[model samples]
Target: MKKIKNNFICKIIEKDILKNKHIKIRTRFPPEPNGHLHIGHAKSIFINFNIAKIYNGKCNLRFDDTNPYKENIKYINIIKKDIIWLGFKWNKKIKYSSNYFNTFYKYAMLLIKKGLAYVDSLNKFEIKKYRGNLKKKGTNSPFRNRSILENINLFKKMKIGKFQEGDVCLRAKINMSSKIILMRDPVLYRIIKKKSHHQTKKKWCIYPTYDFSHCISDYIEKITHSICTIEFQENKKLYNWILKNINIKKKPKQYEFSRLNIENSLLSKRKIKILIKKKIIKNWSDPRLLTISGLRKRGYTPSSIRKFCYNIGITKKENLIQMSYLEHFIRNDLDKKVNRAMAILNPIKIIIYNLPKNYKKIISIPNHPKIKKFGKQNIILRREIYIEKNDFEEKNKKNKKKLFINGKVKLRYSYIIKAKKIKKDRLNKIKTIYCKYYNKKQSKKIKNNIIIHWISKKESIKANFEMYENLFTTKHPEKKKNMLQYINKNSIIIKHGLVQKDIFSKILKKYIQFERIGYFFLKKNKIKNITFTCITKLKK
Candidate 1:
């Protein structure tokens, strides 16, 4: 385990605990099971889990699946998988807000009996009108003065599905004149005639609101620290108010932290669903999406993501993390463990002149230059080879930096080669470059300016290389006039490439550096040919 630093927040938390200000430090990550987890969720999971780990306390994984209309078992399963993938484990059994439905109902009844809450019969519009503005006090609802017996009877009828949707709601009896709009007699329960919940089927019709259920749930779980995003900062008053009013054994402290926001991506589940529905994106796991599954499909390791989040550091202020910073972490991780291989994306055929026609040999190359014990692989050497087309220059007289006719360049892990002639098609596009190999031991000469990757024509494996770039051209895709217009049309470029045949014999999930190119992964397409997906590091 890494050492914990004495930061201000940590110090504050420790001081509070030392003075017996709070009990055991218990934190919980309460995610709504409506969509796949994104980068923002990663931050919350890290903070909650790491805080508990540091304090020798406990962190619970709780799904706030209150909205049955939007929540699903699929989302719940994916969220659990993502949290475990990021290397976190709940101290106790997984929990859901719906699990406390009966307890929440009892609490609501208690509030009604104590004259702190009541059942409002006003419709949605009338209820909002009575709730009033922030500057003025709201008028009491016509049913606000109903007898306690009458309110309890009506509430029981609501549970029996006798009330129509939005016809009645249970509202707290707090001051309606308070400046905080949320504190102005907020609704505790509402009527919803939607489908039954996954856990409870038609057991009750009255469902508790988030503001009412969140605090009560934390209190029930005995959570000492209720960590949440900044959006809930305003609701803190209500959170504490509920705890203070309720006869709970312990009161949980509500702390707010900035939510993670990535550039060029939308984190809202509704917006992502719209994109999926409109066919703007292929699916939730589209490479362009910032979901955990999307990043996994793009060949990112869980460790890389965890490292990226840890290095970004936890803070209260909102920060925009650059895509480049993420890429830098991934590149740094792959550089240490990935084996080196040769692959030519834009292949230009190279025919060696003055070489023995029947000669075929295998040249040994180190799998990793830095690790000798990692061993080597044999790459077939032949008279005909394929090199990247960009390696060759048409006008050698003017541009002397690259490989051209009669120019010498070293074939990586092999002898040096000099271009003798170039072949062009009818349109004058270079088709192939005829080169001649020279043994350095015999000639005592070498060229260091240009080094290129190549594969033997006889033993090369045909590969479909998909190179990816940023999905959006702008940093803020949501703010653009038309997000679809900002989609990088050239984000994915396909190329018919070739790699050493030996590279395909292994099924390694590990990253492999393609000599002159970038890192790549062998996709699980299982075709006779391999699909090498290029992992383009985001520039920092």
Candidate 2:
């Protein structure tokens, strides 16, 4: 494991250990299983799990599945798979907020008995109106002063499905005129009718709100530190209030860090759902998005992501991170690990007129330019091969870098070739280029010549390459009223390309770079055609 850099969270943990405040440091990564995990969640995962690992402590993986309205078992499973794919494991068996449904109900009863909470008869809209905003003080709900017995009875009725979904709820009896709006008698429990939970199905109708469940769950799990994002900083007061009013012997400390916000990206699940609804994106795993599954499918390695998170560090101030910052890490990672190969995306046929018909030579090239241990790959150099269409020009075109009539260019890892003449089809397009090959000794005579990647016609496989760009055109798409309008028209460009036939023999799930092209991952390997997703260009 790399040495974790000193951050504010680490400093706190160090102080706690030095003061003998905690013998065994414990943390938990609590993700709500309502949607797919995005890159932002990955930062939290790195902090909690790595903190525990660094301190020789424990970290629990718990699902905060309090909201069953949009939660699903499939989401829970996918979240687990994503975490595992990112190279992490929970300390033990996974946990869920639903696991403590009965205990939460009992705690709510305790609050009522102590006259700290009461059943509110106001509907949601009315409750919001009564809660007021930051500028104005809220008015107490008429039901806020209900007797303890009456409140408990109403709460029981809510549990037994006696009330409609939004008819009534249980609210903590906090000061209505408090400066913090969230402290103004926040709802502790609400009724969701006929909706079954992923873990506890048809067992209860009343569900605990996140503000009520989170701190208590931390207490029950004996978590020493409850880490969350900066948005939850205000809610930390309610988190502590629940723990304090409940008279817990040992309370966990809550710390906040800035959430990861990428430029030209949407991290919110609600907004992602909107994109899916409008068909702007296919699903949570769309390569165009920054969802963890999406990144994994797009050929980003776990180590690269971890390194990015570590370098970014934890901070209280929120900021937008550039997309290039992330691309740099992935590029640095794949540049050293992935094997090198030759491919042509816009191919044009080239025939060596001087070579005999059906001539072939086995050529060996290093899998990695610098790493000898990565070994070499053998490709057949034949008389008939395909180079990129853009590599050749009909005339000089004022650029001596590209192939022109009678111009000489060196093929990557092969002998130099001189374009003698070209064959044009009836449409007046360059159909074929006739070239003459020169051996290694004579090839050394050519100076300042451009080298390009190519593949033999008979020894290549057909492939579909999906090249990706930022989904949004603007840097801050989320700030706009209509993010769809900022969608880049050419975000995903599919190109029919060719790769070496034996590339399938290389390791699957490992990224491969086409010389002078980009890093790519084989998404689908079929008998006739393969699908490769371009991770990033060779340079940022």
Candidate 3:
């Protein structure tokens, strides 16, 4: 078993279990099957699963599929795939809140029996009007005084499809005058007609609201530490209210930790959907989006995402983490783990001025600098080679450190070379650079300040790189009510590059580090577009 890293939540769970030997440590990752899990969900996934692992407990993969209107089986499977891809296994087959629909109805009846819930005849708009705002006390609906028998009859009719949609709803008879708006007689169940549930089909017309079903589902599953994001902090009250009023024997505890918020990242599910519907992005898995599949397609390792969650840590305090902070973990993950190779983004030809006509040999370069276990790969080094265009400059600028013409610059994994002369086109653009390789025996005599990477012209393959940047122009995209106004037009930029022909096979199989550039993953199917997503250029 992997050693579990300690955090504030872990400390709380460990101490709780230590204090009470009778307490069972069972946690869960409950995701609504409405949308794909995003980077925000990753934090919750790590926290719940890692905490359960630390205590030798079981973690359940629960789907909160109470709302059937917006959910489908495809979403359920995708969610399961994401959790498994994140390196976690459920103790049993996937559980759904809809599985306990019968029990939930029984609990609703229990609420009515105890005079804690009633079926409101008022329509949706009237209910909202009665439930006043933060500044005013809510007015009670006329049907709030309905007898328990009448409420039960109406609720039964609701279950039997006797009423149209929004005709009647079961709401908890909580304090309407209370300052907390959520406690003001929140709707427990609503009737949905015509639309069939993905799980339950047309057998039922009434479905439990998320607030009413979430806590009960936890109680039914015996979840010990019901952890969630801080945004649900207000719902914790309602969570306990349902379990408390129903007199549950074993009630699950709800705890909220700060969610992962990154600069310029749009995490809201509704916003993501609008973006996709508007065709601003290709899909939910577009590399610019923060969905787990998007991150995976962008070449982010699960281990890196886990590390990022741990690095951010768990807390009640809210903050926006810089995007660079997330990239740091990816860098650490890919640095030593991936094979290193040279790829020139902008190729410029360099010809050896005085080498032998038949000069050609394979230059061996280590796959990784420190890890010898990765072995090495050989590149054919002919008399003519291609270097990055930026590596060659016609004239030395003031306040410059080193010039290729005056001083010898070491070619990565090869001998140093000095630029003897440069040829230019009619427009005075650099066409070719004539250089001579310093003697290998006396290379130490040459003063070389910088090392440059290059690939052989004959041995390199052409490919297109689609580099990515932040999706939004501002740091806090949530602040902007109109998200389209702040769309980053330059989020993705395409450029042609030259990578070694030998590395393409491994690139298709594993992540490859482009020496001075960044880690890259091969884009599936498209041979010319051999790039997944680039994080950022390496800081030299």
TM-score of each: 0.92, 0.94, 0.94
Each prediction's number of clashing residue pairs: 1, 0, 0
lDDT per model vs. reference:
0.81, 0.90, 0.84
Q: Compared to the true structure, candidate 2 yields what TM-score?
A: 0.94
Ranking by TM-score: 2, 3, 1
Task: Give the per-residue Cα lDDT of candidate 1 at 12.
Answer: 65
Of 1 and 2, the candidate ranking higher by lDDT? 2
> Can you tell me which runs of candidate 3 are displaced by over 4 Å?
1-6, 398-408, 425-428, 505-508, 525-529
In candidate 1, how many Å is residue 79 off?
Answer: 1.5
| Clashes (candidate 1) | 1
After superposition, which runs of candidate 2 have C-alpha atoms over 4 Å from their true positions?
Answer: 1-3, 397-400, 507-510
Number of the predicted model whose TM-score against the real structure is largest? 2
Candidate with the larger TM-score of 2 and 3:
2
For 1-540, candidate 2 gives per-residue lDDT tens digits of 554564788889999999999999999999999899999999999999999999999999999998899899999999999999899999999999999999999999999999999999899999999988989999989888889999988999998999998899999998999999999999999998768887888888889999899999999999998999999999999998898888779999899998888998889898899999999889999999999999998989999999999999988988999999999999998887778888889989999988888898988888888999988889888999999998899788774578889888888889899999999999999999999999878887778458877899999878899999999999888788988899998999999988888887654355788888889988888858688899988872
Compare the candidates by lDDT and give the number of the best one.
2
